[model samples]
Target: MKDSLIQSTDSAYSYPLLIKNLLQAPLVSAPDQEIVYRGDRRFSYREFAERVRRLASALTSLGVKAGDTVAVMDWDSHRYLECFFAVPMIGAVLHTINVRLSPEQILYTIDHAEDDVLLLNSEFLPILDQIRGRIDTVKDYVLLHDDGPVPDSHLTFSGEYESLLAAASTDYLFPDFDENTRATTFYTTGTTGFPKGVYFSHRQLVLHTLGVLAALSTPAVQGRLHRDDVYMPITPMFHVHAWGLPYIATTMGLKQVYPGRYMPDHLLELIDREKVTFSHCVPTILHMLLKSPLSRTIDLSRWKVIIGGAVMTRALCLEAMQLGIDLFTGYGMSETCPILTLAHLKPEMLDESPEVQADIRCKTGLPLPLVDLRVVSDGMENVSRDGRSTGEIVVRAPWLTQGYLKDHKNSEKLWEGGYLHTNDVATIDHQGYVKITDRTKDVIKVAGEWLSSLELEDILLHHPAVGEVAVIGQPDEKWGERPLALVVPKAGATAPVTEKAILLHMRGYADKGLISKQVVLLRVRFVEAIDKTSVGKINKVALREKYLA
Candidate 1:
């Protein structure tokens, strides 16, 4: 009830937090640290900075100006890293187009973002060829290719990416601007409608980088990312800035390796060849790595991975630990500048058994610095930190997306009560570690009891023959809804895993009172594969429509 505002002093210098400033520490301290692309190209941080400047100059030559939108559709490469800085540093908003989206969705986003210039990989040229004329706002294109002669394409390109950068001067100066100016934009992989645009400002990105750096630097021995650690991102760069780790990695000047497209054999090869110490990805990617034949031959003891974009099951955590890989869960959504919490262990908890540690690592984790996270009921009352009382997770942080671009109704709903609603149902323990039980929409109510589909999926994953599983609620005559699981079997399993075996597995947990007796109502179906979103999350929305509809 007091006036807490303070007036600015004339002599005090206000430093605006900008993306360009993040390069200062690394450039001064570790200029020679390397950034590698696949196994082919490598360059120092000093050269990386120079290339960023050159890229900005190239965009300028293409008539890119402050406030203009420059879009990119390419694989994860050194080129994408340059754009992460150069485009925003020069004051133009960078739009990281999700290449995995359907052609129509991609066209819709390109048009919706009003992209002025597009930099696309040659692999996606055919996709563009399919809908070239429908793309209204794009005036120019820059082609990105890895090796060999450039393939012929129908669309007119301004020039190739490296050629333009090579021809530009590295002497261009990046000017300072308002910290709150929009720096980047990308469309969210929304479930029901066309993807919604999420934009972040320069200030928000800077804050997010610092917050993530602090959280990952916590003194936990397992998953901490330090300057000496070699970095690779299993998450796609197009997805929430690969959960915003690239900036943190670049700021720290760590040795970075970019895998063009995620291939199991290649990723494992890179892990062994480059001695990759730290990386992050969705649960599906981790599963693929574990199932890869190369994973059996490689030494993964030195690797540390953070899993996000989906739940990290206990089975997956145990498998990684057995291979000496330090794996854990991180929690956030596209609306969050993506990292909100990390499942790192406390010093005292570090000595626990592997089973206990695996359970701890699979948790959603403790909130990062400057993040205000809470679980509240429908009435907006705070939920008890009892670990069993589930509620919606809501948070406020300097880096959270302000709102969906051009969507007033959903934006208001997202920011209701001044806290960004995560739409995830979770519980917090006395120790402040959060365990997400389910998405608000994914929680299944059976005969008046709430059953966590995530919980059931985790239990099913513990079965030896069950490779990957997704659980959804199906209408039942007796119970309001019953848990139905779609499962993918592990390759080369000695025995086939039937629905009866899966039910018996759940019944064992019910018999031991580990879960409710109603869990006996669970059903399972075998599937060839599970569907995934653009960012590698299990597409539960699509699954529900496929099986239950």
Candidate 2:
């Protein structure tokens, strides 16, 4: 009986969670659903499936086979969306290149990924031209252009993206394989050292898609992402699969609009034109939209946006709420396939004031279903859920990347204990909401007391004069490190917003015991803009080098 239980049956069939499976539901149920790419093109899901197959066939004909890597350097567009499915479906890994990286970094990633085939947009030709000789593994190039004639290039081109798709047959078979096969890879934008490549498996991605769907659909009042919603991704598709929403959007058969590049006016226009109901981005993008002159002219009331990739301040949340936008925070990193928690409101808390709701909405939030999240101390003990005892966030989930690609040392550090360490310091409330205080390395230590840089930044953001703010620890002999703030004043403010004025405002909070009394406003420098990561999160590492260094 024991042997029989362990043995496989001849009649048994195993189902693998491949990317191809994700296409089935949408094809059958919403075949006619529309997919728009900026103002240039539009196609139905029926056409989308055919295009995906054609793309797969084209790549296959060009010597792409199972286990090969295909790299793409393009803006967020329908072409990218097609590659997201087609490459993986053909049993090849998709490398979503971050075009915003420096030329050297771009070269490093391309070489490191060992990309076999590259799909290049005409805009990025200069970048390739600079490093063409150094690129080792890439054998073929496919050019992509949006408008006008495809410009002549020095690099050898196999064929144009559209022309290849047009000539290729749409009946190629996408074979089934082990669900654990690696599907996609992209380098993480780390502050120190070279960017680390984080890859996800087919099983991981499909599970992540399902996990996201369950989280969004289960929520009652706010933060629900449904089928009827028109979706657009402001988050770059190259970044953690646009926080993994593109897969979710496609799986749900939502009408997806791809804004080619993140221009504030263009994004606003697309939102107004497409009646785009849902989107996701980091805080800086939202701030940019609010600052745009065109934003005041558009109707943003119907837009539901998920803010991730950085700390979402209460000030920003309040401003978005005032505009009738549904904005909330989500928590994850590149290592975790990026969506672990979301700051969706509870049913009991629905009656709270907008200000109160905004505060909750900006929190790190509870764990998504099947996400085993814990805040742990140095000894690996779980921290108290008192909403004050902060610890490193360690997690165990089905979808997290096993480790960094080809970097065993960092991979072990990433998964030191049984759980994967997130390197973020956070606390949990009795109600199970996780609020991140600061990254483990970003905490400001003043006379042995740790102050959250994020907390200070949040407090500074409450000041009406401040448009955007970033807080970092400055070296100090007296106290180990002092908190320094860089602020950008709101546009059209008549009041003289000085460093002293902002310091005084923070001092008021310090006196009232609202924040740590140790957190005296040491200095505030008003700046025109804050530096951001490629994906739009505040680049505190860059600011530290500029100011504190």
Candidate 3:
């Protein structure tokens, strides 16, 4: 009986077979459901599927051979969502470029991926003009806007998206390829250096989608999402394949909605008008939405938001809870098909107090099934689940990146000892909830002992006058390094701050032996505001470059 159970689990986890079955399922299952944009333009599942078919045919006709790379640069639009399926259906890998990247880095990724064709929004014409000569491998350019003329450039441009759709046969056949054939490739938003490319296979995408749905998340079980649920992922399709929700949403027959260009006001209007039930993005985006003026007028109580890409603080979680929105925190990276852990409460925690449940829901939740997650210190030794011992988190999963594209040195660093080593240092509780302390790279080793800059930053934020804080290690010959805090004060605060006062606050923490005694506040600089990633987490990489570079 035990053997049979193991075998059944293995069979159910197969990726290729699952994807094939999903693609073949009836399209009418998501009937009357819509993918909306700008509150007015939208497409039903019938029309959406037709567009995807047309896209597939267009790419194949443009000599997009199986295993070739197809790159996309656009906002979260219905057109970008179509490429999520169309490119892979023809066995070619889809590479979603981060439009937020610098022109030079964008060129590096396009050149590194050896993209065969590029699909871009006409809005990026200025940036494209700067790097047109650098990308030599791209054979065709497919422009994806209906209202504008193609931007003039020296490159070999082909046709507009609408024109291609008209020229190609929508009934062009989708060829069957091995499940392991690379389906998508995306560059990680590297904090320090040029972005690193990560690729995923069809099997991996299928498995991730199934696990995302089958998991005991509130939207899956509590929301009663059938084949008819409407999903509008506010997360950009270019980032980690929008955490793979675009594919899963469509395959599950869920009506999808995309907020074109991702204006917060537009997204809010779509949610209210389209009656969107499901969406996902980083915590900061939600923070903006909750604080945005539009949020006051829009109806948001019915939306189910999946927050990931960074840790969720108690304050942020409570704010969402107050709105009666079903917000759950998730954890993953670009390398692991990006779905490592979810903060959904376990069945055993169902009877626990609301506070206790909320704590678990804020930590990195239990690992998805088949994901072997562990926290280890210097060695591969597992840390105690007593919620105190924090260590580097590592994972082993089938869908992890093969390696950084063309960068073997970092790729090997990514998979040390046959496991994907996540630099995130964290602690797990008795119930298996993990809380991240800091990244291993971000940790400061003063006098050969660890000091958490995150902890220091968190404590500094408690100051009545401080609004935001970031702490980074600076070079020191004596202790090897020292910590410095960068703060952004709250608007219109009368209480002035100084380096001495900030360090005095730390003295109490240091005297109690909570922080390093060797820690010294070298300097303090007040800025207009701290910068952040597109997803809203503090951009420490930029800070390091500006201060420590």
Best by lDDT: 1
Name the regions of candidate 2 deviating beyond 4 angstroms: 1-8
TM-scores for candidates 1 onward, in order = 0.98, 0.97, 0.88
lDDT (CA) per prediction: 0.92, 0.91, 0.78
* Candidate 1 Cα misplacement greater than 4 A, ranges: 1-12
lDDT of 3 at 473: 83
Which pairs in model 1 have colliding backbones? none
Candidate 3 structure, TM-score to reference = 0.88
Please give, for residues 387-425, the per-residue lDDT of candidate 3 as tens digits. 989998999887788898888999999899888999999
Q: Per-residue alpha-carbon lDDT of model 1 for 1-549, expressed as tens digits?
A: 888897899998788999999999999999999999998899999999999999999999999999999999988999999999999999999999999999999999999999999999998988998896898999999999988877777889899888998999999999988999999999999778899999999999999999999989876586888889999999989999989999999999999999998899999999999999999998888888888889989899999899998899888899889999999889888889899999998888888999999989999999999999999999888899999998999999999999999999999999999999999999999999999999999999999999999999999988989888899999888899999999999877889999888889999999999988989888888899988888888899999999998
| Candidates by TM-score, descending order | 1, 2, 3
Worst 10 residues of 2 by lDDT: 1-10
For model 2, how big is the CA root-mean-square deviation? 1.6
* lDDT of model 1, residue 271: 90
Candidate structures ordered by lDDT, highest first: 1, 2, 3
lDDT value, residue 56 of candidate 2: 96
